[model samples]
Target: MAGVTAMTVQLNRMDRVSPWGFRLQGGRDFRMALSVKKVEPRSPADGQLHSGDAILAIDGYDASQMTHAQAQQMIRNSGNTLQLTVNKGLFQSLKPTGPIKFSPAAAYGYSHGHSTF
Candidate 1:
């Protein structure tokens, strides 16, 4: 018999540099993209990002086009501020304009939820 152990990190702004806490899951195929699986509370992603949010772009880096590792690296490299182009809903629809941007210096933190995944 074999056993597998998993650990979930409590994403905290003070703990992480980027503070954009979210689980990335996807990139299996063309149809499947690197999307948000879970958004942690008391973190940068808490209020802004929902569960189903297909991270179209992070600081202009396309998640749908890039591999999962690439997207993660981009997010980590974003530092304290992050500019995201996201599609929110059951089905992703690309809008011509309007992007969401958040900086660590802004009014944010604490825990809550409104998951769409």
Candidate 2:
């Protein structure tokens, strides 16, 4: 993570429109669907997404075939009604077995008081 890990995540059409407030990160090869790195508070994705949850798609576009830009554009153009298919099992597997020792900030990919998102 040398440069800022950037990806545009937008929310579904609702009473309030806001950024989905989640960071999507993964290797560019698309061998696997991108994973949710963080979910911001009170955003549309906060309760529905979790860190490490594999994103299967946005709307009906398969995430397996998308580049970062394509994914971003798709979400931005989805008319405020983005639908996310998430794999919660993957997220559970990524969780620590013992009590969490790291700070919440660190867990969400914060480094040196700066957020990567």
Candidate 3:
């Protein structure tokens, strides 16, 4: 606490600071993590995934290690299109997209195919 003035903090979408904070300059860890879990049939998961399927990653970041609280915050912060690094039961991949697609003609939203990151 000596010689401390102010701290720049990064909060999750939920407005909570990481209870566990580690500061290692230029630190990086490549660990598989689960980030998002979209069980909506309108999502890429749809019938392809079941209720409990854990959607991992966003674009190329492993989200599995992230706790559920972390995951929720990231999802909300990502603005809809999330590029994740995912790993599931044996199928691993990246998906960048939104929950629903907007149709000009229909003036409504519909499910769109998951795009490759």
Candidate 4:
């Protein structure tokens, strides 16, 4: 947890049918991490949450091992009030490197792929 910083956010659902007003990124396939990708303007999470904030838990349940679908379901199931525990620094620490180009022949050493430099 060297780069992790945790904080809690509470969101109030205007009604049963209203949207959560935030978008998420990352999943088992992507990186086994969940992060806030977008916060709709003037929404409940607008000021409380931020893009790239890593979700550490939903309510009191751990979210580190959850898939995107599972996490979504958990949020949806949370009625009225939704409490989130997030790591504001975790996502920044996990930043992706620039695009890497590779050639099929590079594996066999037939041709050297472009260097990251």
What's the number of clashes in each of the models? 0, 1, 13, 0
RMSD (Cα, Å) for all candidates, in order, is 16.5, 10.3, 17.9, 9.5
lDDT of each: 0.53, 0.59, 0.33, 0.71
TM-score, prediction 4 = 0.72
Against the true structure, what is each candidate's TM-score?
0.57, 0.58, 0.33, 0.72
lDDT of 3 by residue, 10-103 (tens): 2222232212111101001223333222344343333343322234553444554654445545544564244433223332334446764655
What's the C-alpha lDDT at position 71 in model 2?
64
Clashing pairs in 1: none
Per-residue lDDT of candidate 2, residues 1-117 (tens digit): 243232334356463345766777642343445677777888777777778776677776678767655666666676656677766636422334687666764676643221122
**Most accurate candidate by TM-score:** 4
- Give the residue spans of candidate 1 off by over 4 A: 1-18, 28-31, 91-117
Residue 50, model 3, lDDT: 34
Error of 2 at 117 (Å): 8.9
User: Model 3 compared with the native: what TM-score?
Assistant: 0.33
**Deviating ranges (above 4 Å) for candidate 2:** 1-17, 27-32, 89-117
Clashing pairs in 2: 13-80
